[model samples]
Target: MDILADIATTVLSQLQKPTLAFLLGGMMLAALGSKLEVPTPVYKFVVLLLLLKVGLGAGISIREADLVSLAVPAAAAALTGIAIVLLGSRSLARLRGVSPMDGMATVGLFGAVSASTLAAAMAMLDADGIAYEGFIGALYPFMDIAALVTAILMAKMAQARSRNVIPQNGAATMALGGTGSADNDGPSENRTLVRGILTDTLQSGAISALLLGIAIGVLGRPEAVYASFYEPLFRGLLSILMLVMGMEAWSRLSELRKVAHAYVLYGLSAPLVHGAIGFGLGMIAHQLTGFSAGGIVLLAVMAASSSDISGPPTMRGALPEANPSAYVGASTGLGTPVAILSIPLWIWLADLFIGL
Candidate 1:
């Protein structure tokens, strides 16, 4: 009963926060047929700023962090990403009316990190006075890259198997070019595919911005500028981003109607399940590294989030045969809103169970 009360209280409190309020407001505006829109350039700029702030803070924290303490949580994050993709592939991907490639693409998006959701989680933690590691943001790439790579690789393997040209082990052989027919170009093709995915992921705007900021923060002393500029603008920028996302999420809802009911179910439920998996793994990491409750909650948030910015373009390039309506519709329409709203639940659970 007390836990239930606490959850209700947490949710109510979070709804009042500017980050969430703006999100809800945006959604309401869109629902009411308001034509209000944040320009594309403006939204993109806001995202870059938010990512830079996160990366800068993380880089500064990492500079002073104990590397050994960071390793366990990082590994946990990577494992969580891989696990979510595999879990979805087995379940959601196999659902009636869902194509395997489209399902993998959808799960891949969910597996990847959301910069906006991560920012919101950070904002919520700060508002609640929850302390977390500075380097926590640094774990983004580890999970994002791992999930995407694993998803694409799994899809390719499935495709190869379907074609009967490559066995399960043959995928590796194709990449490594061992003992296969010399005339077979499978090895070159596989290597190129893997290389292309990695290159595209790294070059994506979101990842590139975060990574650049981290590099700058680590190598150069940006504390004065970071404090003066990025710090002050963080929340305000995030609010705008949230508003944009909320409106965008509303618009995407129509796309969901074209997909299966299973997608709707997966979109609604996956966030909670994936988040729980992250929270559990984070607890294990906490036992090993004493990861903070705030960090655990953030880890859960990362797991819950879908990649609105990076995953789509990468998936389009990699899995062109996959139906965009199914993956994109499910993610932007249902998954993201659910993930954002669930932030408070995760935070409350962390505080109640894991404490500060």
Candidate 2:
């Protein structure tokens, strides 16, 4: 009873926040076709600021954190993320009759983490006075990299398997050197592609901000760092960025109709499924690691959210056969809205799991 009441209050409090108000306002303006816009560079800067702030806060908290205890949850989060990617992609392909490449693309986008959703989760936690460990921010990269690799690999393997290699000449056939090495070569090229994709993901603005923030936070004293600009301006900047994100997400919603209903349904249901899995894993992790309920909640939300920022371009580059409209549309369109709306549900699930 208390849990439900607390969640109700928390939901109401979150709805009343200026940040969410800004988000809704941005969506409304976009809907009305208002010319107001945040410049591209400015928007990127805001995202960087929010990511770095979160990372730095996490780093400072790690000072007193137990490495072993943290490892348990981190490991669970990583495994759960990988499971989400594989299972989600396979299910989309099997259930939707989507081409293998397109399904992988969708999975890659949804399987990864969303920085905007992470910011929203942080905002929710603060509003609710939830206590979470600092190292939770570090889990984002692990999931991001894992999902990217899995998507690329799935695409490459499917492409290789689908090809019907035929020799046009006798000498050319002899040079073919059997299916073993040729098959080996495909996987090898995929590995190289995966490596390149990983490099790009790590070097992206979001990941870079997180890495830089962690470095600064780990080196400086927590009190001094929090008193500095990083702590003070984090939430306001996050809200503004989310407002822009909401506008961007709304713009993409029309693209949903460009694809099949299966993609749409998958996009809509992804957060709920992934969040439940994450929440379950987090509950098990709590028993093993004794991590805070807040960290568990963050982990669950992080797992639930899809990557709208880094996922599309990378997947398109790696899986050119896939329809860009389908992956990008489903992800930013149905998926983003579903993910944002699902934040409260994830928190409520966290409360149920953690007894908070």
Candidate 2 residue spans exceeding 4 A from truth? 1-10, 165-190, 219-226
Candidate 2 colliding pairs, count: 0
The collision pairs in model 1 are none
lDDT of 1 at 252: 90
Collision count for each candidate, in order: 0, 0
Ten consecutive residues with minimal summed lDDT in candidate 1? 168-177
lDDT of 2 by residue, 30-114 (tens): 8999888899989888887778777887777767677887678878777777888789766996665577778888888887888
Residue lDDT tens for model 1, 1-356: 98789899989989999989998999999999999988999999999899999999988888898978889889999999999999999999999999889999999999999989999999988987899988988999989999999899888767766756575434334333345564546666677678978999999999999999888888889999999999999999999999999999899988888888999999999999999999999999888889989999999999999999988999998888899889898888889999999999898888788776
In model 2, which residue pairs have backbone atoms overlapping below 3 Å?
Answer: none
